[model samples]
Structure formats: C-alpha cells, structure tokens
Target chain A: MTDVDPIALAVFLFFFLLVTVLGFLAAKWRRGDTLDSLDEWGLGGRGFGTFIAWFLIGGDIYTAYTFIAVPALLYAGSVVGFFAVPYTIVLYPIIFIFLPRLWSVSHRHGYVTPADFIRGRFDSRPLALAVAVTGILATMPYIALQLVGIQVVLEVMGIGGAEDASWFVKDIPLFLAFAILAAYTYASGLRAPALIAFVKDTLIYLVIIVAVFYLPTQLGGWDSIFAAASDSFDAFNTENADAIAAGEVSGKGAIPPGAAHWAYASLALGSALALFMYPHSLTGVLATKNRSVIRRNAALLPAYSFLLGLLALLGFAAIAAGITVDNPQQAVPALFESQFPGWFAGIAFAAIAIGALVPAAIMSIAAANLWTRNVYKAFLKPDATPAQEAKQSKLMSLLVKFGALFFVLGLPLELAINLQLLGGVWILQTFPAIVFGLYTRWFHRHALFAGWAVGMIYGTWTAYNVPAVGDPDSHFGSPVATVPFLDIDIYIALTAFVFNVLVALAGTLLLNAMNVDGGGDLTSPDDYKADAGDVGVKDLPLDEMAPGEVAKGTP
Target chain B: MPDSTRGSRNTRPVWLLVALLLAVAIAVPLLVPLYDRATPTFLGFPFFYWFQFMLIPIASVLTYTAFKLSQAATRHDRAARGQKPPAGERGGVS
Candidate 1:
C-alpha cells in the first residue's frame, strides 16, 4: 500500500461535512407546521410526487452496494457478478405488478410498516409480530453492510483502521460515521435522506460515467481489458477447468460451469425478491404522493440498472490496470485513485461515502417505524399519541444506528458477511406472506402462518449446510453456495418460497375440508384501490372490534 | 354486463390490453436466457453479459405503452363516474 495522502483525504472529509450540514438543514427546507406525527417524521408527510420519489427510490436501491460490492464480486467471480445487472432489470416488472396496489392500500389505511398492514390484514397479533421481528432483523445487517461500503472507501483513502495503530485509533472512523449518521437521522427523520438523495445520486452518476470512459482508454482500451480477462479465463479453463469440473481447485483462474451459472442466477433472483422487502425500499415507496408515482418510477429506474452494468465492468478494468486493493471491496475506489487525478478520486470517494448516508437514513427511519407501530404501541403504550410515537421513533432511530455500528466494528468481515446471508435467508421467507398477499388473499391466515414456519425451517437448515472453499465455517456462502440434490445455490429463500406455496395450498385444502371458515377480509375489495378514504387514527385500534365484525383476515 | 352499454364499445379493452402487455414485458426476460449461450458475444460483451443491457431499452418501450394504455383507461373510468377530465389531463393515470 502507498503512504497516506492527507490532501485528498481532507477534500473527501470536507465534502462529507458539507453533506451533513445539508442533511441537518433539510428539516427546515421541507418543514411542516408540526413534526409530531409519524407521517411527518417517517414518510415526509407523504408529500413527495414523481420528481423526488424517482431520485429517492433510485438512490435507495442503487446503493454503495451497487458501487462497491457488485464490482468486487465481479473481480473475484467472473460471469457470476453480472447477475446484479439482470436482477435489477427484471425487478421493475415484478414490482410494477404488485407494488402500486400495496402503496394504494397502505396509504388508504394510514399504515407505516408492512407489519401494521399485516396486523390489520390477519387480525392476528402473532403474525404481525413475526413480520415486525423479521423486518427489524433483516434490516440491521443491511444497514451494517452500508457501513462496510463506507469502511472500504475510508480504508482506500488511508483514513480507516491502521495496521499497527491501537484499537481506538483503528476503529475511530466506524464510531465517528455512526455518530454523525445517528445524529442527523434523529434530528431530521426521513426528510434528511430524501433531501440528501439528490446530492448522492448526482455524484454517483458523475463518478460512474467518468470511470467507464476514462479508465478504458488509460488501460489500453475496452478491447484490451476484455481481451486480458478473456485470455485469463481461457488459460484457467485449459489448465484447471477439469479440476474445477471435478470439484477441485487446481488453479485460481477458472470458474466451474455449474458454480458460475448457478451463482449468477441465484444472486439475481435472490436480490430481486429481497430488494423491495427492505425497510428502506418500502420507506421510499411509502413516501411517494400516489400509486402512479411508484409505478412510473419502477418503469424508469432501469437507468440506474444500466449504471450498475457499467460499474460491474470496472472489475475487468481493475484487472487490466493491475490494481490490487488490500480488501477486495476497495477495488472500485482504488481503481479511481490509480487511474484518475487526486481531486477526481476525492469526488469518487465522496460519492460512495454519501451514498451510504441516504440508505442509512431511510433504513433507520423504517426500523424506527416498526418499533413505533408494532412493539411500542402493540405492547408498551396502546394509548400513545402521535406526538409520543414520533418522539419514540426519533430516539429508536439512533439506537438502530448504534446497533448496526456495533456489527460493523466488532465482528470480522467474513462473519459480518455471513450475517447478511443469514439476513437474506430469513428475509426472503417473508415474500409469500407479504408480497403475495398484495395480489390475492386466498391464502388463509392460519395457512400463511404454517407456510412461514415450513419455509423458515427449510431455508435455515439448507443455509446452514452450504460450504465454501477452505471455509466450511462460512455456512450459507453468499449467493454461491448451493445445497445438494437441487445443486442450486442456497438462495434458501427461493427454496423456502417453494415450500411455502406447497404447504399453503395443502393447508387451505385441509382447512376447507374440516369445515373451517376462513376469516373475513378486513379491507373491502375496493379499499385496495383507494388512496384516501375515511382516514382515522394512524394506528387502527386493535381492540375496537365489536363481536362478529370480520377479524382482519389477509386482505 | 356490457350488453346494456349505451355509447361506443366498452373501454375495458384498453386496460386488458395494458395488463397483457405487462405480462409480455415480464415474459421477454424469461425467454431470452433460454437461448443465450455463455460464450457468444453480443455488442463485444458475452451474450449472458449484454442481454440484460439490451432488455433495458425494450422494457422502457413496454413501460411507455403501459403509460398510454393506463391513461385511456383512467379517462374512461373518470367519464363513467360522470366527472370531467381535469384542466390538466397531462397526468394520464393515478
């Protein structure tokens, strides 16, 4: 590694400070008369129309993960990393089909988290609790993953953990970043992220466009880079493809056919399904003014996906440039520094660092909403006012930030990576019950519960058995490790989804045969199409049902 | 249900058409990979690598079609409710 450059680091740090100031000032920029309700704090008063929702959801979905990890995966795994490109492309149609209906229903009912909808949909406290806990659990690691992105950028810029430095000196960046993130998020709530998304997306686009054109020329050409990568792949296949085919790694260059193709498709589908389920993605959708905004954004957001395809190719550019990042995740940042002038490299670093801020803000806000609507009111304070709920959410947002900081600082990178894999397995189990529930309520409430249980069991068991090269301890290897028989990567989530469908169908049959009556729909068919109607308490009173009133079944 | 309609034929066809186009939009990606070989080159990148890039433009065309179709449906729905189209009919659908 080269000696640290203080000047470039200072410029990057200054840009981050500018963003923090902007974040704090956003409270006044979008100020409402009162910021005491969850609507104001969590969803930005639901005032965002098409323009802001486009940038907000774009910034949220195309994360530092897009800028950093996807390319790192490409550098490490060849064709497999390209899956992110297609997964994002396919995600639009999947979301377009169902997400607008979800937005219409949630906005009509004044719901904040998906869990709140579940509580009203199933009229079952236990199931809503499951959704809430899963959301919180799934979101924490993702928030931490953003910190990992920031960590890589800092390390490349010579600002993070030193080799011989004391623990405090080494870990100060993680603590300091979380401190700033938590403070602004607590102060401005969702408005902080929504406003900053404008800056984040502009910088990211600028950096990626420059890198795609600039680096290819410096590295001889796109032709040279591709030729080098292809030659490298060919040599590896000639020498070790047989060994790789026989389940042995004779050389480090070639990817086995099964390993390459399965990893590509698994990561693609797994990420697509998991993408919308994240609290941050939901926060972006919920903040929009109407259902059409959500649909139109989904239709247009592939512009960012095209950017991702460019970013992934930078991996091959890094290979051609002969750049070596100490951590593979720093591949993109290091590519910028080696190929560009110091000032532009500083700008690129700022893009990644600020990219972390938008998603981090949205994630903490979504988690806080979960705590407010589900745990705090459901158990702690059933009579809580809007003002009190907002207060609790602001505080809880800070706690979630610190909780994620601990994951980034305390654990090894490998273990932290495993937690994300575990998060995926657990999160994907929510799809059948949550995403599918948007379309049809045919799956009975009890049957939904049974489906969840079956899926969770199968997903976890298969994930626990996946093994990686030289590390059996790394169970459920990220999108690449597959279980036997199916010989597919342990997107245990998809496997779980299949199991969920089977059990749900069978359970429905058995319940009907036993003369068990399905609970009535909590929402009329027309409610799914309503955006504003009979708006009452934000938290629908759980105990207000008169006898024989239809208990909220899956609606 | 539509036999008693008074004016021109029902406009529900526009919505059904949009929904069918959405299904087709979704189906194209499912079909592309079946024929894509790993090593074949498209636009200097492998077929597997570049097919998704190609799909983006195709999807945008489909989205524009849906936008137009939904606009017509919304106008029909509004007319059925005995409401005039707003001063700005620029925004086709809700």
Candidate 2:
C-alpha cells in the first residue's frame, strides 16, 4: 500500500537471487549423462524420487494463484471460493486411482505428452493434435496468470505497476524476474523447478505456518474470525436486501445457501477432475520414479491441503483485523504487510513470487514438450532425433514463456482471465480421450474425437453466453450455468462432459456397426500395469520408437 | 492366459475394497448438503467449518489404506505376469 519498504526489499532480493542461482545449478544436480534429451531436460531425467516429486507436484498444483484468489473469494464474500478445500480433498483420491496408470503407459511407450498417449492409444493424428493444441492453449493463460500473481505481489511491494509511470517502468521489474526464470528454465529444463521447489516450498510453508498460527491470535482467535466473517456477511445482506431481491446484488454468507449447494459441489468436483488433465500437472506425475511414488504422494500431499484450508481462512482473518483493499486479490498481501514486521513481510512477498516462478517454469516446459513431441516430432519432423527433439523443446519453452508474457503485458488482463476461464472447461474436453482411454479402449477413437470436439464447442459456447451477475450484457461472467433441464446451476464443464459421454457412446455404436476402422491399439493391457523396472519401460531411445507412430515402433 | 486372468479375478475383492475406499473418499465430500449448516460449533468454529476440516484427515487415512491394499494387489498382478514385485516394493521408491 505504501512505497517499497527498504528492509523488506533487501530481504526479498536476497532470497530471489538465492533461488536464481539454484535454478542454474540444478542442471548439474543428480547429473544426467547429458542434458540434451527430453528426459533429461523436459522431465529431469524422469528420475525424481518420492521426496522431490512431492515438492515438484506440490509446486504445480498449490500455486500463487491459490494464495491470492482463494482468500480473495472469502474477503469478497463469495462462499463458493471455499470450494478449493474440497476440490483438493477430492483430487488426490481421484489421481491415486489413475495417475499411476498414466505414468506406467507414458514410461512404457516413452509417451512424453498426453497427446502422445492419445495418438498411440487411438492411432489418430487429428485427435492427438486436438489434445496437443488444447494442452498448449490451456497452458498459456495459466502461465500468464502466474505472471499476474508476481505482478500483484510486486505491486503490493511498490516495485512496478505504477499507472503514472511509462509502460517499461511499470513492467520492467516483472520483465526482469521473468527473464531470469526463462534463462534458468531453458538451461536446466524441469530440473530448474525441481531443485528450486525445495526453496519455494520451504518459504511457503514457513510463511503460511507462521501466518495461520500467528494471525489468528492477533485478531482474537479463529472463533472470532469466523464470527466476524458471518456477522459481516449478515450486515451486507441486510443493507442490500432490496438489491438482492431485484437480482442486482448477491447476498453474501460464510457457507453456501441450499440453492448453491449444487454449484459449490460441482465446481469442486469439476476442477478436481480437470486439474491433472492439464499438461503441467501430468508432467509432474510422469516425472516421478515409479508408481508407488505417485500413490504415496497422494496420501502425503493432503498435508498441503490442510494448510491450504487455513490459508483460505486468512480471508476471514483479514476481515476481523479490520483491513480493507479495493482489489480483493491484494487482501492477503495487504494483510501481511500490515501485520508482519518489515523483513518478514519481505519473506512473505518472496514466497508468493517464488510460488509463481516454480509453476511457471514447470508449465512452460510441459507445454514445450507437448509442442516438440506431438506437433514438431509427430508432424513437422517425424524422424527427428532425441537431440533435435530436445533442442526443439528447449527453444519452444522459451517461446511459450514469451507468449505468456504477451498475455500478461500485451493484451488486457481480462482476456487472459477469460481465456483461462475457458481454458479450464476446454482442457476438460480432452479428459475422455486421455483418462477414459487409459481404462478402456471401449470408446472408439473417432467417437472420442467427436466427443472432444462437441465438448469443446459446447463448453465454450455455454460459458460465452453466461452473463455476469448484475451486468447481464457481459460474457464469461461465471463458470457456473443453469443445467439444461434442471433448475440448479453447476459447472459448465461437467455438463459438457455429460453430453460428451453420450455422444461418444452413440458415436462408437454407429461407427462400429458401419465397420469403420477403429484404429489399432498400440498399447497392450499390460502396459498400464508396467512399472519402472519392467522391460520396454525406461526412457526409450527415439530412433527405437518415437511416440505417436501408427505402426509398432517396439523392437 | 486363462489362469492369469483368473488370478486377477480371484483377488477381485481386495481390489474391490480399494475401489470402495476410493469411492467413499471421493463421494462423501460431494455430499455437501449433509454438512451445510451453522449449528453445533466446535471450539468456536461452526459445524460447517470444523467438519470439512476434519474430513481432510479422514480422507487421507482412507487413501493411505487404499494405497497399502492396492500395493498387494499390484504385486499379485505383477507376479501373475511373471514380473518381480516392482523394484519399488523391493525397497521403497528411490
């Protein structure tokens, strides 16, 4: 809120440089034979153990966006924001059942991206391309949103985002931070984030642990915190009863009302189902050493979920502490600056900024792998060698980061957010092809493709038509929409998914009866059950079998 | 092939239990209407707030046990396929 605190600035810079050095140094840590293969660079040799994989995956899922937006929802009196807690609670149980299957198949076939799996499983180029393109498209706004996370923290620190300042000055600090991130990621690939995650998680846990335990006592206790939030919501509803009745204003509460119970549950469930489908989340899963690593982490990772719930409650604490901010995203940051001492606030700022950096690094690398393996290797240069493929991924990671930069700086922030809003629903459309295909090839390849297309078109169109509350003319206002036949509202993505399944089932039956070629299943049933030590399951040399080959590439 | 297929089917109940645990873990949280209330505050936190926080640990334990039970089934499946207990089981994951 004020000009940069000099002591805080020094503390933030010290940790920033510390991690900057760690990012470059990671290329040599647990040295791979060469850092020129996708396995080495894009996936950190596909060699992370349980401990490192936990931090890496944690970094990807529990992002800076969660810190900013989750609390902001409560601060802004949006009850559904609390859905994040249940979303994460449900997420691990779901992934435990499936991610190991993905890791096994990915390692078995050297399938570097989900699209690689799609192409190999379904043997359809167009379908693989759809999955690949959606991964990249959905990923870009996400990386941009990470930049927005850093931008928010920097603005809170008085570093950039001065409206009066020239454009360069307004963006220069963020530009510099991203430049450092881009260079390290290009140098070290997945290793950069994996190594730095240690530092990022340490800072994050320290700040959150201290903030949760310390902040509550400063403003009485959790009892008063919840009471204050409830009272505040009640007060607002009383004042805005007329506007609420007129449908111009939303009534606020600590818990979702009965009418919104479906909305609350659907958003949580839909997001949980959609999350691992994102390329970045899958990248972390595939990067681990073996199947057990994933399952154990599923059990362990909920520790973060517990802390995340407390972090969400910080919104209520901010209310009780009598802090106010115009942009709700700044509420937690503002609360930190007001309550904590100078150096500690600096550490908190660094935590959020580094939180942004780790995920951004991982996302760009994942999207880059998708482009190199699925788009470049699969189509542009089918016989490209491992070295050439890695070269392409290295260069593509840089370009993907630049595209994200453009999203943050070039276009309006709303465009990136709206696209990200669509990104969630858009990415879910690929779920049937990737997830359903893992368990059963019962869904026909072309049928799944048609399902994907229908889902994507329907989700985008429905989301586009959902006007904002009070601003009936605006588009993409809410992610929830009224179900077609039901009076209740739920996430549009889930509804689209229902339609997608019906179409896929119908399409499969019709296609089969007409004797359409269903494409060969390159993977055997045992492939899903393959583990690290199994034959044909390590990182396959590219010439032996580059992923997405229609014919059997297995020697 | 029939023997191996039957081998997997013979162990179906343990796999079924894992499935049941996971199903409960996933479905119980989505039944939000059951806990959507302000009555019966626990240590000053509302029933709604404290109850959801409590589900975190319950769900974690359920998943943990599911992982343990499934590991045994996975080992049996691997043995049926004439594979070792997955270098993962020989020692913990590297």
Candidate 3:
C-alpha cells in the first residue's frame, strides 16, 4: 500500500558502502610477502587455517544463490526447494572422503587447478584444457547468479529511485556492487574474499536468526503461520488441481507435486557432485595450509550447514507473512522489509550484499587461475615468470567480473537462471576426472574422454529439448530444461554424467579387452602414498630421514 | 596370511576404519528414510529435517575421527615397513 521508505534505502546504501570498504581493505589484511605466483595471487598464499577455511569455503559455497534462489524456489514451488538442504548434507560426507585425497595429490604435485592435476595425472594436455575450459565456462554464469541475488535484494529495498526504471537502470545497483568486487579481487586476490568472509557470514547469521524468530512473532505464532501457508498452498492446489495432478504446478504456486521428490533428489545429487568441481570450491580446498586444515574445516563446516537450514526456513516465513513481489526472488528480502524496522532491514540487506561479494571475489580469482595456468601459460607465454603470471591473472580477474556483469544485465532474468542450470550440467561432467581420479588411478584416459564426451552431449540434448512453461517459441535455446521422458525439472548435467560414466566403462572394457593401448600412467602406485620425502620437503628433523634425503630432511 | 607377517599386521586397521566410516555415512541417509516418520520433533521442525541437519555435525566428527585414525593407521603401516612415519602435513597452520 505504501512506497518503500527512502530512509531504509539510505541505510541499506550506507551498509553496502561499509562492506565495499572492508572488501578493499582486505587486500592488506592477509597480504602475502609477494603476489608473484598463482599460490599468492590465486590461492591467498595457501596459508588459510581451519577456522578461516571454514568461513572462506563456507562463504564461497553458501552464497547469494542459497540466500535468494533456494528460498525463491521454495516460495515458487514447495517441497522441491528443500533440495539445497539435503544436497549440502550429502556434500559433506562426499567431500570428507575425497577432499583429503585431492589435497594430498595437489600438495604433492604443486597443482593449482583440478585441470592441472588432470594434466599431471594422465599426462594429457588436451584433457586438462577441456577441464580448464569447462571450469571457466561454468564459473562465469555462477558469478552472474550472485549479481542476480544482489539485484533481488536491491530491488526489494527500492535502492534506485525509478518506480518503472529501464532494465539497465534497475541493474545499476548490481553493476556498482560488482565493480567494487572487481577492484578488490584485482588488488588482493583470494584474500579479499577470505577476509570479508568473516563479516559476510556474521551478518548473514544475525539477519536470518532475527528474521526467523522475529517475523513469526510479528505475523502470528509458528503454528498459525504454517497453517496459513498450508491453507494458501491447499487453496492454490484446489484451483490448479489438474496441474497438480498432472505434475505441472503444485497448489502453492511454488513446487509442483508430480515431480517434486525426483527433482529434489536429482538436484541434491547433481549439486553435491558439481559443488567441489567448481573452480571456487577447488581454490578454497587448495588455499588451506595442509591436509589436516582441510580435514578440520570439513568437520567444522557443518555449522554453516546449520546456518543454511535456518536460511531455507525464511521461505515459509515469507509465505506466512503474505509477502509478494513482482519478482519471486525478492520473497525473503521483501519479507524482511515488510516485518522489520528500517535499521534491521538495512542489516539484512548488508548480509545479502556482502554474501554476494565473498563468492564473487573467490569465483573471479578461481576463474583467473584457469586463465593464467590453463589458458595464458598453456598457450600465450610458456616462459612467463610468477610476477608476470600474477599481473596477467589480475587483469583477467577484472575481465571475468565484467563478463558476469554483462550476463546479469544483458540477459533476461529467466535466461540468467537457466544459464546457471546449464552451467551445473556442464561442470558435473568434470566429476569423474576430478573427484574419482583422487582415490583410484584406474580410469584410462581414453575411457575418461569417452565418458566426458557422452555426458556433455546427452546432458546438452536433454536440456535442449526441454521447453519453457507455455512457450512455443522457445526450444533448444533454454538453459534449464525438463528431462525428455521423466518430465522433471533438474540440472540436465547429471543426466549427461550418468551417460558419460556408462560410456566410459563400456569404452574402457571394450578397448582394453581388445588389447587396445589404454595409454601410459604418468604416476605409479607408489606416487599415491608418497610423502614429503618423495616431494623433497626440506627442513625436516634429523632423526626421521627417509632412504634418500639430506640430513635436514630428517624428521 | 602369516600371523607374523608385517604386511598382514599393518594394513588391516586402515581398511577396517575406512569401511566403518563409510558404513556410518552411507547408512544414516539410507536408513533415516525408513524411520523418519517415527521420530518426533525437536522444536517446530520435524525429525526428518532435524536428522538431515544433524548429519552435517555428525559427519564433521566422523571426518576428524577418520583423519586421526588414518594418521595412526598410516604410522603403523610405516612402522611395519621399517620406515619412519610420514609427517602429517600440518594443513591448518597458516
């Protein structure tokens, strides 16, 4: 009934400015002695401890995507939206098993990206190129999705004065926010994100905990609140009974009923597998000081998962508050403004804005690592120095930020969302090589190539055939699509993954049994369990020398 | 299979621990679906939601446990091999 308060807008801008200042200053907080190598620029000197790793990786993994989209999906769909929660839960155990091995291998080989490991492990440059290309491609849209989250929060706060502003004007807030991100990342590298993570996560917790308890009390008790939501869901379902029965839309205008369970499970699995494969997640893992830091962080990170559970519940709270907006993505932010005072709304907005920044910085840095190691050094300048590489990576990080900004502004909102879904499908193709390669060195290079190709093709086609709701003009161009026969909305990437694995197995056995050359192994079995003695860790204690090392290498 | 052989004595505990940890992690999600409805609520949220949420912390404890056990087991294996145990990479120290 009333316009969003200008005072609320001003306070929101003030908090956002504070976060940006913090983001810039972060460049100095963990300033490495030199920013020459990818280790310094790309990984913040690989010096993060367990608590910092938890927050950095947590801030990376739990982003504005989790804040805006997951709840948006719940507000729009229903039960299907809960996939994010389970996916994260499934992710920890999976990482618990695989990540230590990844750390050991990465540490052993001095590898920067998963592609680097792939290249070293199989001695295949072409495959490493594919992994690098895929990492960059998948990361760009994901960074854009973070902008979408910021856009939703900014729009909810009515930051821009225009009531019916042009599309560009509506997104100016996002552009300015990302510009700040680009600058800090270019100057500080991964440390910007790692340092800002402390603030971002703390703010997110404050906002969500307050909103979860405050909104319910303001509207009604939790029971009455949920009852109202259930009523709304029931009423909507009754009207759209045929659609509900047909599995098109659930009564809640949120998750449809027919394919909810399947969609939930598929999203959970697809997201879990895809999570670590992302360059940002890998960057976080690599930035840790040692295998134990990673292990300790893995144990401690469930606390963030606890925070995620609280964040997801904001959707039901929004529903209970009868919150509605032109864009469904604004459901949670809008709910906060509607229920809370001007000061608190400003704080909630800060959380979302800062939340977007942390991931964007990490993602940009990770993408830059791909460019420097996989693209630039691989092709442009093989003889490049660490300083030159760092300089080149800094420039490339800015370019990646702008690329994401364009995607956020130029594409339609739905298209941006779809592109990310497509990105998931695309990144999942790397799982077999990245995660599976850590434990067993058995998968042949030819078999992996066959698997990767099959997955990419099938996932793309399955996604292509999926038409948008009630859009005849749209066909292959859509990003997120329903499966051909199953008719469920999922990251088409997993479908491709399943097919790729099958083909790889088939291709490997068929080729191997026929005495086809499976190719050479770059690493032997002993390499898997090799310690610093093999890698030549200097300054070891004198008493514990291995068979071949100098006296200083003794433990 | 010799009772006195070093290979047989050393590798057993590492395998046993890996299997146990894997079983617990894999079992909770698979088994919880069976008794999810039977479990009662903690607060307003259901047992299903709580159990899934609980997995995060539980999994963390399991990982730290697994890591410690793996180190100990690896040391035993190295001792049997008549080599000094490898230095556990101190990952958390910046």
Candidate 4:
C-alpha cells in the first residue's frame, strides 16, 4: 500500500468522492412527482432527451471493463482483439433498425424491462420469465467484470491486494469503492448512473484524446510503435512454433488465414446481436424520452467507437514503451504510470474507476428491475403496488451489487472472465423471443421457450467442452469452437444462435400444425410506431393515479 | 392511423437505402481476410488496424443520413395530414 503514489491516490479519491456526491444528489436532480414508482426510480422517470440518453447509453455500453480489457486483449492476443471495434460498429446499424421499434412499443405501454415487452408481445408469463431470468443471470458476471476493471487499476496503483496482507486488508479498497457505489445506487437507482455518466464520459474522452495524440509522440511515433509490436509478436510466434505445432498454444498475431476467419466473423456478428439484449443496455434505451432519441443516439454513438479504435492502439503503444506487467490487463495503467506524470495517471485511473461505477450502477438497476418486475411481482406478489415494486427494486439493487462483489472475491479472475464470456453466450439465446417478437407473433410461445432452452444447453455444453490450447483440462477456454460437422472454427455463440433460430422455426411450424394456440398478442403493429405524445396510447399508471396510490397497472 | 400509413409508405425508399448501407457495413468487416494484413499501412498503422478505424465514421455517416431521411419522410407525411411536426423533432439538429 505504501508503494501507491500519493498524488495519484489523492486525485483518484477526489474524483471518486465527487461522483459519489453526485450520485446521492442525483435523487433530486430530476425530481418526478414522487419516488414511489418504478418509472421514477428504475428508469429515471423515462424522460431523458437525446443528449442525456446519448451519454447514459454510451457510458453504459462502452464500459470500464471494455476500456481496460479490449486493450488488454490486444496486449495479450493480437489483431483478434480488434474484433471489438467492428462488433461495436455493426451494432448501431442493427439496433437502428429494431430499437426504435422497441422504444416506441415500450414507451406506448410503459414497459419497464425487455421482459415486460416480451410478456406483452407473447402473452406468456413463462416465456417472459425465461427472458427475465436470463437477463439477471447474464448481467451478474458483467457487473463483476466491472469490479475486476477497478481492481486492476487499484493493483496497478499499488493499493489493491498486497502479496502478504490478509485478505480483508488487501481488498479494503475494492470494498470501499463498492460500498459507495451501492449506497448511491440504492439511494438514486438509475438516476445515479445517468448523472454520473456525464462525468465518466467526459473523463474518458479527455483521457483517450490525450493518450492517443500524446503517447504516440512520446514513444517513437506510430510507425515505431507498430514496428515494435510487430517485432515482438514475430518473435513470440517463432519462439512458440514447437508449441503451436503440437497445438499446445494458440497461434498469435492477427486473425490467421482459414478457420480463424470464421472465428473473427462469427464473434463479431454474435456479439453485435447480444450487445443490446443485455438488460443494462435495454435499461439505457428504455430511459430515453421518445423513439427518435434512440435513432438519433444510434447515429451519434459511433463517435465512441471511433474513440475506442484510438484507445485499442494504446496496447501497441504500451509494448513500444517497454512497459511490462504480469497481467496483460494492467498494460494500459502500467503505460500511464510509467510514461505520464503521477497526476495525469491519477486522472486516467480515476476515469477508469469512475467508469466502473457508471455501468455497475446501471447493471445492478437493470438486474433489480428484472427481479422486481418479473420474478418478485410476477411470482411472489402479483398484487404488488408501484411503491412496493420500487422498494423491492432498490433493495435488490444493493443485493445485486454485493453479489457481484462476492463473485469477484470468491472466484479466480480467469473463471470470472469465463463466466462473462458465458454471459454473452447466454444472453444471445433470448434474442428470438425479444427481438423477433417485436415484429411478429408467428413463433409459438412454447417454441420460443424450447428454442431458448436448447440454445442455452448447446451453447453451454459446447463452450464447456472447448479446452485451452496448452491446457486440455481447462474447459470453456475460448468463445470459438468447431462448427460441428462443418469442421470449421466459429464463435460458439453464433453456432448456438443458429440452432436456436432453427429449433424456433421448426417448433413454431409443428406447434401451429398441431393447432396449439400461440397465446394472444397485446400489441398491434401501430403500437410499434407510437411515439411520445401519441393519442390514445396506453397511459402510464403513474400519470393516471396519485403518487403512492396502488393502481392496477396493465401487465 | 392514416398518418402512420403514409409515414411507412414515404419512408420505404429511405429504409431500403438504409438496409443497403447496413448490408455493406456488415459485409466489409466480416470479410476479415481482405484487410487482415500488415501492409497497406496508413499513418504507420497496419491495414488491419486502419481499415477498421475508417469504417467507424462511414457507419456513423450512413446511420445519420438514414435517420435524417426517415425523419424528413415522417415530417412530410405529418404535414400532408395537416398535423404539426413533433416539438422534439425540430430542435435535435442544433
């Protein structure tokens, strides 16, 4: 702990405290009629305009883990890590086509979560329950990954876990950070992240712009950086040739020819499809005021992707700067500490720590929303009022945050990473129910459920069977697997998603032929086009009833 | 209802254009082997690195154009129906 730089620690603490105060103050920043409703607490009163929604969703999607890990992946692997850039680029256009429809319909019916939309669209509580449970489960590992991001920054700063310190003393910093985050999030719900997002994005853009332009010059410029990176990788590949020949280690440097190409493409496509399905991403989209905000932000949000490209280059710059750490995850922070002054490194570290705060807050809120709306209210207490729902969500938000904390502390970081990878694989299974159901009701409810189950089972089984190149005993070692019978390696998530869609299609036809009723559709095609201020839309219960009064809100 | 009908009809061409742009966006990046190389460097960055970076703004511009075209089509439909455009629609550009 004494190895931590005073200036950096001080600056980090300063920004952390500032955001904590902002988080508490956020409860009143955008005051609604009352705090006794899910709309106010869970979705920030559902009135965020384009600018705020841009910051919120941007801050949510481009998370702290991404800031740390994408570059870390580049540091560890080569061009394969660049998969993130394309995955993010393609995501906006794909979401551009569907998310506006989601926003319109969700807004029309005051739907609070994607599961809410699923329930309404499919008219099946059981199907919606599956989507909700998957969302909560997938989001837990993501929230834990954000904590890992903070821990990496702390470890680089030398205040993380000491080699010989007791576990309690070593993890005090992580616990402290999580405590403030949990307190503020419990106090303000989605508003905490919504307000803090502005600060997080500002710090991130400032740090990235400075690092992108300044770091390259400090090293021997971009050409030297690229040369140094290439030289290192070339040496590495040559050194590992015997191991590569024996398939003891994976090949290095960019996506190699042949099957690696399929791996890269499928990972990109599968991730793009899965990105918005995460409950946290939908939480951001649901917070916007109108349909056009979603569209407008889709256009503007690519600015972050451009920034991310610049950030990914920092990995090469780290290699060129001759900064080395035991963990590739520490590469960026190590680069900043070695190259920049202590004060600037502190600012960069604060940008990342605060970065973790924004998403962790949103993810917990999202998970809590799922629990309150889908699990608790749907199962335990169908008669729960809005006030009761908000109360349960706030409590569950705290529980979810701490659950992620326990996850980071209890599991090996490798296993945590594996779980997060599995999160992506799991969340994509819900796409057929949520995304496809937005456009049509052709898929039978039972068929969608069966598809989700099959996708989950196949994805997990195949992912579990994949062994690390050097360690055959290590299961779930990679997101890519053989495409089964095709004998080409592709992203396991995409393969499972293909199976998901097929089973759904076949089952729908079979179920329809058997004359199984596909349940009722509550939303009309016009509902998908209903924007804010549209006439005769379903009125939000909050607007119709007095605050704190129990109203029978439409499911 | 008639406004929405007109809105969909007028935006059909714009949607088709958007679909084409999106197709190109997905295809160029998925065809990884085409630009997955060390040569053809720009500003000292490899072709693999620079080509993907270049796609960011292209995607952004295409998306923005589609958004504007769709909005304009919707506004035209609303005007034809003698309804004023939504208030939030006007101030977004600035």
The candidate scoring highest on lDDT is 2
Cα lDDT tens digits for candidate 1, A1-555: 455667667778787877767866865765663443424233422445656544444554556667777777666644455666667776776677777667767766766567777777767677677777777777776778777777777778877567688888777667766765676566655555545556766777678778887778888876677667667666766877777677554233322354455555555566677767755566556555555655666567777777778787887788788776556677888888888777788888888887776666667777777788788899789999989988888787777777787666644453234445456667777777787777777777777778878877887777666655445465554434455476555456676777877888899788878877666657655556543222321333211110001101000
Q: Give the alpha carbon lDDT tens digit for every residue of B1-94 in model 1.
A: 2221433346778778778877766666545345346467654566555666788878767876776666556555645755444213535534
lDDT of 1 at A380: 87
As a TM-score, model 3 comes out at: 0.84
Give per-residue CA lDDT, model 2, range A454-474, as digits (tens).
998999799879876687877
Pairs with steric clashes in candidate 3: A76-A254, A77-A254, A77-A255, A78-A255, A237-A251, A250-A256, A290-B91, A425-A493, A541-A554, A541-A555
Candidate 2 CAPRI-style tier: medium
Better of 3 and 4 by DockQ: 4
* Alpha-carbon shift of residue A62 in model 2 (angstroms): 3.7
Estimated TM-score for each candidate: 0.84, 0.88, 0.84, 0.88
For all candidates, state DockQ relative to the true structure: 0.31, 0.69, 0.35, 0.55
Instruction: List candidate 1 segments past 4 Å from native.
Output: A26-57, A162-177, A234-263, A385-391, A402-422, A480-485, A531-555, B1-19, B30-43, B74-94
DockQ value for model 2: 0.69
Q: List per-prediction Cα lDDT, in the order shown.
A: 0.64, 0.76, 0.64, 0.73
> In model 1, which residue pairs have backbone atoms overlapping below 3 Å?
A121-A553
